[model samples]
Target: MTAPPPEQRPDRPRRCFVIGPIGNSYAAHGSPERAAYEHHLEVFEEVISPACEKFGITALRADGIASPGDINEQICRHVIESDLVVADLSGGNPNVMYELGLRHLWGLPVIHIGEDGQLPFDIASVRTIKYQRTRTSLAGTRRRIESALAAGIQDGFELLTPARVLRAIQPGAGPAPERPPARPPGREGGGDLPGLLDDCASVEDGLDGVTGQLAAISGAIETVGTLAERSGAEALDLLQAGAPAIARLAAVSRLADALRAPAGELHALTRDFSARTAALDSGMRTALGLVEAAGPEERDEGNADFLDQLVSLDEEVRAALSRLAALSASAGRMHLLSRHLREPVRDLSGALRQLRSAVTCMGGWAAAARGLLPAAAG
Candidate 1:
């Protein structure tokens, strides 16, 4: 008989939340700044994304999450929840630093990286991968990150209990939030078979609710990704065009206004999405454990009544899990690309810079014309 697959030690689903710049639109398209930006994107996509896929990990970022919630708060939630964090500190981006700081507070391992010579001194003491954001060099970076992730998995590291960090700080400075109390088996409904079955039934009902929530979250994420995609090519168009090329400032302004972040929608979707995924994960573990444990020590492809009973339930569980995985994969991609959505709105800053430069150039020309006029008058 084919031996039953080993009763595997259950582990947390690995989630790698990435942190980095989404390439500044204001940078000249062919300039080094643009190259670096693209390089960062490539590393996350080609290098990091594939590496995560290899390990069945979910890698996400802060932008364009279809979850309806505040962006900052969503980011904070990921910072708290992610199994591993991969931060690109290129050019000492303040936002990366801030999120990295938040990750540190959890006392979990964070893999820090930056463009060589670009990481700030304050964090220099922390071990970091000083990388050259180029195709040739990214293999090394990917290896380092994957190695760190493998290490994290071995440790089964994820969220931290606040008690450890809380004690180190000033007394009464800040209180850690209380965790919901877990119920004991015998304490609930006198622990009889019928009562236990009722508890199981209630859990089954809750899983149904969580499943519906996940479905809504998936739809919302798809919508947010759609909106973010619309902003990219248009922003690139504006960035590549110069002052003389912009015949109508009003048209550009209108475009920028239209691209104004679908921030609220994204936050709502992600907030619900993230929470539901967590709940679904918990439910999945419980359900799978129950089934596996109910079967013989070495489960077989048998025609027993109990095995027959689980056939439909097993199919249902697998179907729900597949959808959940799909949602996470899509959300991870959306998270990576969503940050770039803001760049179109941010082009207003770039536009102002261009206008200032043009105005200064015109002033210089006017001065020259004035000098010529005085000479002609003389």
Candidate 2:
């Protein structure tokens, strides 16, 4: 019964996959475990469902899929493809953690919530909305969730999980390529090579955007630094005519404020690129499976051309990664130049982490694709 935010609807329908511990159905009808299962269902229907409804998002849990198909594959697809994921970490369910980890690697939007006392120590730093099962508490929880979802939909979700941190620190290591799922039955015709190529092109365009944003941000910082240097007595007299120290402090504040927008834009752009590369990696892996399934005899010149373009795309990614790293390092030096700027640097930090993940994703896909070309020709 929480009041919804102002009417805001996405251009297209959005899907949210919910992950949590669905208690054992095999337990006795009157058993505690079975009762727990029923409780979770009630939570879903009353709390989660209504929250998603206000935003026009369709929410589904793993067991809610109507189609009769491979449930594991379906869950994986939802984790990778859904516009958002809500992970319930109560009791630190292993399945929920695994799905959450996957969603983190893709660097898409996710919201974490859990029972007040049950969150794991490992993810203790993550911002999770905690709630009790009391009717009053649950209502408050729903309102909190509505606010989080509204911000995510309007502004964008910025998550910094351990997986993302590890990738950012370890530049040479990309996420280990997931084993390609078995090509579904009747998929023998082939994979969408052209679609894969288009995805790569889109990534290229995105990199260009990131590069431009970085340049603009760097210029902004330089201008701020120049203005701050002029905060001495002579310059202060000509400008604000205030104490030199006060003028310098004011200028430092302006520098940090100036960084927020460009840094935010870069973060948003790189986050989108990160998701695209993750999907491209998955698609390329699927394409490899189809190629392998077709036998090398079916390989043709078109396959070779795609592989060549992929190699070029990989080089571009590597170059962009180098540039982003260098710029991030420069930003760090600038932050040191003005010690009060750390707060505003948070967005730049997120942007760097996302860019690193995107580069790693594209690199993994390229490595997998490289093997396919020679194998196909043979």
Candidate 3:
């Protein structure tokens, strides 16, 4: 359970809004810049959407949303309000740059994405997920983004979280943008991330319960898989021994019922536990962040103990999340295996039906033969 990066992750609104060039007002219609703009759209639809869906995040585009009021107001709201914002830096679209700057001023994390060799020099130092339009490149990028989203990794921050922006909107503005509100005394910081950390810490006491339930689900899934495999094998043996159709069907029926019980229970349990784990990560990611520590003289023994508690709690939360993810994966595999196990049972049932029909036909033939023989003797 290594400590997560020292950064507070805000409670994501569970939505990601795209900020990029969707227009060619500056570039010619058939020019390379226009082509690049179209390519970005493709990347969003093909690559980003899948990854977002996998982690339960909704992806929205600037133009896709509608509002009765000003469109700029809507865009600004999403820029400030969305849990996550992905900015496309290709061609250095002024609108994108402006919006990206605004998000940074608010000190929220924004994922920068662009084409290789196309970012402006100023932002070149910033970490950007560059990609080509090729199928392979897009596919790999999707995987990378999904992994980052799951782990709460940011592409860039701080530099993006600029201290100020021009408030006057004029050349040589009177002064820089207003500073964000100061954090409260004795608190980690302000904004969504700090508050979210506090919210998550509140749930620390229930972590033990979550871990126990996850363990139970994992065990149940394993047990179900084993039972299904054994039952299927036994049914196969009966088939080879030429057992009565009724006996084979009855045996397989019992196995099918047994398999369903655990699979269903584990599936539901896994779903519920996964949600809790995600919530825990949401808070721990922020709480474990590297806020400014007070000087030695400012610190007391009580402060030291509190810090230790936070470190320990963070470690526990990370471990629990990792375990929960693995358990969920195991449960998924078990669900699939259970379904596979029932395939043979179904086949056996069909075979039994045919066998019963064959036996009935043979009895009818024998009865007719006996009647014909008596008639011939007469």
Candidate 4:
């Protein structure tokens, strides 16, 4: 099935707050600058504010509030309660920046705007809507801002929710942005079914890669064990047969130490990957809901297709998880092998001490034998 465009999806309308610098002086309204401020306020009240209302949004302006302290708390409360925030950064006002910072901290959906030529440096990364002081420019800005807000609203309020932001940064999960459909017109069935199949294929490939890595690590662990056994047995033989065991013991110790780093790294990677996979699993389920409730017509051509894609994606995710599990098991085995190797090293240490004692005893025996031989010969 073909998925619907994001704008057509069923979601809630937004509640927006207009935040910026407001006039401070009580008698300043008679001045030209205050008149300009009033004009700007009139544009919002007459033009921008009504657009929000027409779109079933509740628009609140930040102007009437008294002090920066009150504005700060109010902005925080509004950000938490409202669906979106429209911030005017025209004056490079410090208070505006502070309020914007609060909105960012809450992970609120913010539409930034500035008077043409008044853009700030710090907000360079974000795209901002620019308007002129004239009526025509303000009208155009209102439309653009409203359109952007509409798109955000359709994506669900969760799109700007703090949890969603946190979820996006989580490892193992694909990005929060919607995934493109699997196939284009190039393949069979107008490219829908083929896309689903492709998704499945991708999952299979990921699983295969994970499995291969697991196998490689497992093989390395086995090799370490075999090497340890061979070296340990040789060292034991040298000790029993009155040959020096230092060389054999040292070789075994060095090999064990060499294996430690890789084993540790694999273990840490396994844990991090597992955490990432869990986050992905949650996100997939959420996406599935989005696809399923996209209306009946969307389900017809895109339903089966979307389901197919989802299933394929799920399978791939599971396969990767399974591979991670296998790797984890292998890590456990490596840990056990490392412990086992340590035992042999400990035994070698004890054997070295015993060998030293024997060497000392032999010296005594040689001295007594030398004395006896000399006396007898004399």
Best by TM-score: 2
> TM-score per candidate, in order?
0.39, 0.43, 0.39, 0.38
For candidate 2, write residues 1-378 as lDDT tens digits: 011121342343388899998887778999999988987787777788789989998899988999989787688788767777888899877557767766765555788889999898768898999989899888888888889998877665664553344233343343222222122234334565332223235444654554454455345444433443443334356456555666666665676676666566666766776776654454354444344433344555555666666676677656655665655665676676476667546666776787778767667657756767775446
lDDT of 1 by residue, 181-275 (tens): 12222333333323212324644565456445445544544544454455445546665775243433444444334444433443444355345
**lDDT, candidate 4, 1-378, per-residue tens:** 222234543355456777775653354758877775786686668666876886787778765545567554566567545656778888766556656654553444677888888877767667789888887888888889778767766653333332243233442233233322222224335443433323235333543443344344344444444554565576577667877546555654665675455444444443443343332332233333333223333334543543443344334434433443443343344344345355433433332333233233223323323332323336
- 89-165 per-residue lDDT for model 3 (tens digits): 88776567767765664555577888777787767877788877689988888887776676554433332423322
Best-matching candidate per lDDT: 2
Give Cα-based local distance difference scores for all models: 0.50, 0.64, 0.55, 0.51
Off by over 4 Å in 4: 1-11, 29-33, 64-72, 156-378
lDDT of 1 at 84: 66
By the lDDT metric, which is better: model 1 or model 2?
Answer: 2
Worst 10 residues of 1 by lDDT: 1-10
Off by over 4 Å in 3: 1-10, 24-34, 153-179, 182-378
| Backbone clashes (count) for model 4 | 6
The positional error of residue 245 in candidate 3, measured at the CA in angstroms, is 99
Error of 2 at 6 (Å): 25
